[model samples]
Target chain A: MSLDKADVVKIAHLARIAIDEEMIPEYTNNLSGILELVEQMNAVDTDAVAPMAHPLDMVQRLREDQVSEENQRDKFQEISPKVENGLFLVPQVIE
Target chain B: MEWETVIGLEIHAQLATKSKIFSGASTAYGAEPNTQACAVDLGLPGVLPVLNKEAVAMAVKFGVAIDAEIGKRSVFARKNYFYPDLPKGYQISQFELPIVGLGHLDIELEDGSTKTVGVTRAHLEEDAGKSLHGEFQGMTGIDLNRAGTPLLEIVSEPDMRSAKEAVAYMRKIHSIVTYLGICDGNMQEGSFRCDANVSIRPKGQEEYGTRAELKNINSFRFVEKAINIEVERQIDVLESGGKVVQETRLYDADKDETRSMRSKEEANDYRYFPDPDLLPVEIEDGFIEAARAALPELPDQKKQRYIADFGLPSYDAGVLTADRETALFFEQVVEKSGADAKLCANWVQGELSAALNKDGLEIAQSPVNAEMMSGMMQRMADNTISGKIAKQVFQAMWAGEGDADAVIEAKGLKQITDSGAIETIIDDILANNAAQVEQYRGGNEKVFGFFVGQVMKASQGKANPQQVNELLKSKLQA
Candidate 1:
């Protein structure tokens, strides 16, 4: 589960974070430490216990399927970096 | 060695809910960009997701229809990835525990043989916004109107052996969802779409080969073509002493080939963990029972009923029940016209379908309705018009000429059942064609057809064929 410098660099690239070459070693150490702690947790023998996903034993709240919102495109698009023809524009992205 | 193609599909059916899955924003299509995106859909600070009961009910309905295990408690997980279309860095979806468990769907292949495809699971997820790449000036445009729309991603086992079987499996799912009234099943609008995982191995290989996923194929035809092309590519690669690389490929339908989009190493990790904002969904027996009770007759059941009750062929039943609107139209025609089932089936499949195809219209968009069609059928039944003249009358009705009665009256297309008028026409025809009559009486029975043609010509094609045959036989015999 230990992450090396190359693994750290790959992770950073996937996350779209521009990290310096010198910072990769430091990230590798920190990420490997976190993974070691997770491995330690995973070492426990609690096979009979049911897996838990939520802290509180509560079910999700349900809402009626009705449209209550009105059009606010002009106001929302005002905060975007770029917009044209009622579309939020970005640097071109190919599939 | 013969190669075998194995395929499994992941279908995303957009649920027909009034609003987004976790927000109050409208989920209606073709809205102005970002207008329908509410605070929750936009991932504003400190926003939490609440499940839509209608969407949950719909998922339950599908589970019950397919006879799947409806999970009493299902956890929602956050699949973390980065993309421009995803306003939130993570999409809320189910991973380990889905709402629907292992199920099966029975699909009828082209050879009229049925096969059961195993359903791995169906999970709920929120859709990302659409990224329009080419429309703008070298810039990508994002439409958030589709953001947070609810989708049921149905995963299937690797049970398909060919492209045709895969298409059949997809079509069965399409019919089922539309029949349940849960999804609109509009592939063009992208309410229904699929990603296909394709692989190929030797004829008797126990283990599957490295698979490639064909992403976001929107139509059934494209699904078949994409899978066929991918299978051919994989076989070719293996035969050339190369291995098929695990990757995501895009089907360029215009080019009729699959090109690599991203390889396994470049693929996103999609680190998945349970969502903290939303709690696990728990269902009660009462809810499941109510959903089951509310379920309509599914496509397979309706197809069986059409075959059993109406005596329709298996193929006709399949075609008629492929869509809900067409089935309802057929039922209405039967109820109104009280016509024979086979005749009704033939007319709907033959004349009506042909006309609809010619005009590029769906049954729902037909200018002539069930009532109008039933009236025409009645005219044909009562010896009022021949089937040939009925088609002409239908064309007239389609041109907005009026109903059956009006069209028949305006065109004087009614059958000539009047015995006295037919007798006069026959006598005039006989007097004019003395040579043909003599030939007929001189043991030349083949000349009877000419006499009948002459009589029909004199009657302007209004003579009832059966009556004309009987009357001409007696006259020629005497």
Candidate 2:
């Protein structure tokens, strides 16, 4: 359940976070501590208990299926870093 | 050593609702980029998602149509991932408990046999926006119009042993969804699409081999080809003493090959947890009853009814009921023309289908509709036109000439049922073709066809064939 320095680096890369070499030990210890907590939680015997997806027992609110929104492309794209031809532009993504 | 191919399909069928699943933004296709994306769909901070009632009803309809167990309560979860198209950094989907569970679809195979494919589950989810790559130089354009659209992701068990079975299963789902009017079932527009998980193992092996998922294949043909190619690739890798690597592959239809898109090492964790903003969906007995009552006659029931009532062969019934429009058109033709059920089936599946295919039109888009077909069949039944001439009339009708009677009259293509007119044509043929007549008299029974052909040709192909034979026989004997 413990994360080492290499594991921290890989996790950071997957999360797209930039971390300095000095911060790897700190991240490893913090992540491993969380994992150890999860391990301790998993050790409890609860064979008869039903798994719950949410803590609240409330039901979902249903909405009417109608087109109630107006076109706000110009206004929404105004906050983007880049936009062209009514599209939000981002740096090139390689397939 | 034989290899057994295993396949499972995950189909995404977009619900035919007016608005997005979580927002009131328009779900209409081909809207201006980002126009239909409201604040909720754009994933603004503090915005909550409200489930659309119509979308839930459509999902329930599918579950009922497939005879699946409807989950009384299902929870929505956030599938965390990072992509340019995913503005929210996650997708709202059902994880552990889907709405529909443990159903089986009975598919009629090409060999006139039926096989049941197991459906693991069908869950409701929101689609991501499209990233328009390669169009903008050094940048990608994102269109969020498709984001938040409702999709029912139907997952199947790995019960398919061949590509054909997979295709049949996919097509059966397509027909059911379209028949229910829940999905438009347009694969080219991506309203309906599938991802195939394929693997191969030694024959009779209990354990499954590593599976490679082929993603986002739109057409049934592509689904079949992609699975076959992937199966072959897996078999090759296994035979070469190399273990198959589990990965996600993309089917390049143009090149007819599947290449690795991403391997397991690079795959996303997709940490899924229940969304706190949206509550668990609770399906009451009233809603389930309403959905059941609203279910139309599905394809299987329609096929069985066609077989039982119309006395059609299983194959004919299957073909007619494969599509709702075709089955309705067949029924209308039979009801209007009062033709025999077998005859109606033949004309619809044989002649009408051929004509539709020739023009690249669906039955709904047919220039010669069911009424026109009934008229043509009625003409044939009443001896107004022979079977041969009816085809000509059909062509004329399709060419926008007129109805069956009008075409037959305008072209003088009516059958000449008068015995006297046929006798005259036969006598004229007998006189002109003396050598063939003598050959017939010399006990050459096969030469009779030549006389029939000549008489019909002299009569401008209007000579009633039976009458031509009868009259020509009496005269030659005399």
Candidate 3:
């Protein structure tokens, strides 16, 4: 349950957040602590116990096949602050 | 120099549930920035979250579709994080016990090789709101309409060895989501997103090399590109005797390069424990059976049936079965028009696909449907409309729906198949192209094309080419 300090630095760089050297030790400690808990989970002997995956076991839910929806144009565009008429307004994209 | 690329994918698909995964607010897209959000989504004091039933159903639906085990009991865990977009300061997700277990899906490689990709597991989680960067002074604007929306994190096994296989697997996943009606399957809409884990090792190496995970690759093409570039980068690093570091990266589509976003960290420290608020979700066998029964025909099975039943080629079956709507449309066209299934596949792939892209419309919005297309194709087969005039009729059919007969009648686009009309046109073409006609008589029979061209021009391209060619040959010989 230990992550190297350098691994913490690499993770921060990959996540694109600038973290100073001071935060690296803290992150490393925290990450290792979490992995410790995860390793504890592995100790439980339950090879016979099936892995529970999804919560729902229903076979199927069928909806009456019908084409019944309108293309909500005005309603969809109403939320955008940058709307020109019916289209989402974006900054001038072309010269 | 023999090496192989190993690729796996982590896909986070926004579920089709009406409400947010844990909140009562509507989980709709394209909504007003902060309006649809409830107090819980806003993270107000003491607002607890309740999981949406639809989301559970959707998760079960996917499990059933893939023939994966439905966890009769599952629990949601809290993933602690601090970000401006995550108002709750933690997302509710499944970590220890996922909702769906391991399953295998088969995909066909481009070179006609088949391989089965392994699905690691699928877990359900709630989404965080978006942070709008680059809006003003680099200050982020938070949009909560998407907050608390349900997402299923599907992790795949590192079974793919090439960029093409990776994409094919992703496409298969996309088809499953769409076919299950569990997601809109819109990659551009941020509804379905992919994070690829890529590594490269020597051709015969058993132990895998350190893998780099790339995030925010939204499109399938970008996923393939990112994987290929990452593969090359890893190869270069190993060749130079430098160790590859495990980190998260972003694919800059403009630069066509991947840059390290951060080092990969095991987030287990989020103190992931089952949320105390929600009880362990218990799914009975009856519930699982119902979800299983609702599974639609998956893409691979549908593709195989199109081959065995419809006599479509493997490639044709692949293209048609890429999407559920496209497959259904092709089948309906084949049924209603009673046209050859092969022709139906061709017309749908050729003309229907072109029109759908040009107009930026979904298959549901197309003016010409499967039946109308089949009708038009059948008419062409019967010589009621030459293939040339069929285009004109097709253009009309796209703008407005009328069968081949009505569209042809309104647009006056019937094929000139009558022998009398064709003969007259052929005679005129022979008179007009006397030089070419004389050449044909003088043993330059290859010049016969000159008469066919003139006949087409005289008949305004409505002349049946086969009929015109035969009539012209006889008249010229006589």
For model 3, residues B34-132, the per-residue Cα lDDT tens digits are 666666776767877666777888999998887788887777888876666676667888977788988878899878978988898999998887666
Docking class of 1: high
Q: Please state the CAPRI-style docking class of candidate 2.
A: high
For each candidate in turn, the interface RMSD (Å) is 1.1, 0.9, 10.6
Q: Model 3, chain B: what is the TM-score?
A: 0.93
Between prediction 2 and prediction 3, the one with superior lDDT is 2
- Give one digit per residue, the lDDT tens place, for model 3 in A3-91: 99888876665445798777788889999999999999989998998654335442322222122223344554465465332323333
Prediction RMSDs, each to the true structure: 1.8, 1.8, 7.3
Native-to-model Cα distance after best TM-score fit, residue B8 in candidate 1, in Å: 1.2
A68 in model 3: Cα distance from truth in Å?
A: 23
Question: What are the TM-scores, per candidate, against the unseen true structure?
Answer: 0.96, 0.96, 0.82
Query: Please, what is the whole-model Cα lDDT of each candidate in the order they appear?
Result: 0.90, 0.90, 0.80
Model 2 has fnat of: 0.91
The 10 consecutive residues of candidate 2 chain B with the worst lDDT sum are B262-271
List A-chain TM-scores for all predictions: 0.92, 0.89, 0.52
Q: Compared with the true structure, what per-residue lDDT tens digits does model 1 show for residues B302-371?
A: 9999999999999999989988988998988888888887788888888889999999888889988999
Best candidate, DockQ: 2
Residues B181-235, model 2: lDDT tens digits: 9998888899999999999989999999999989979999999999998988888
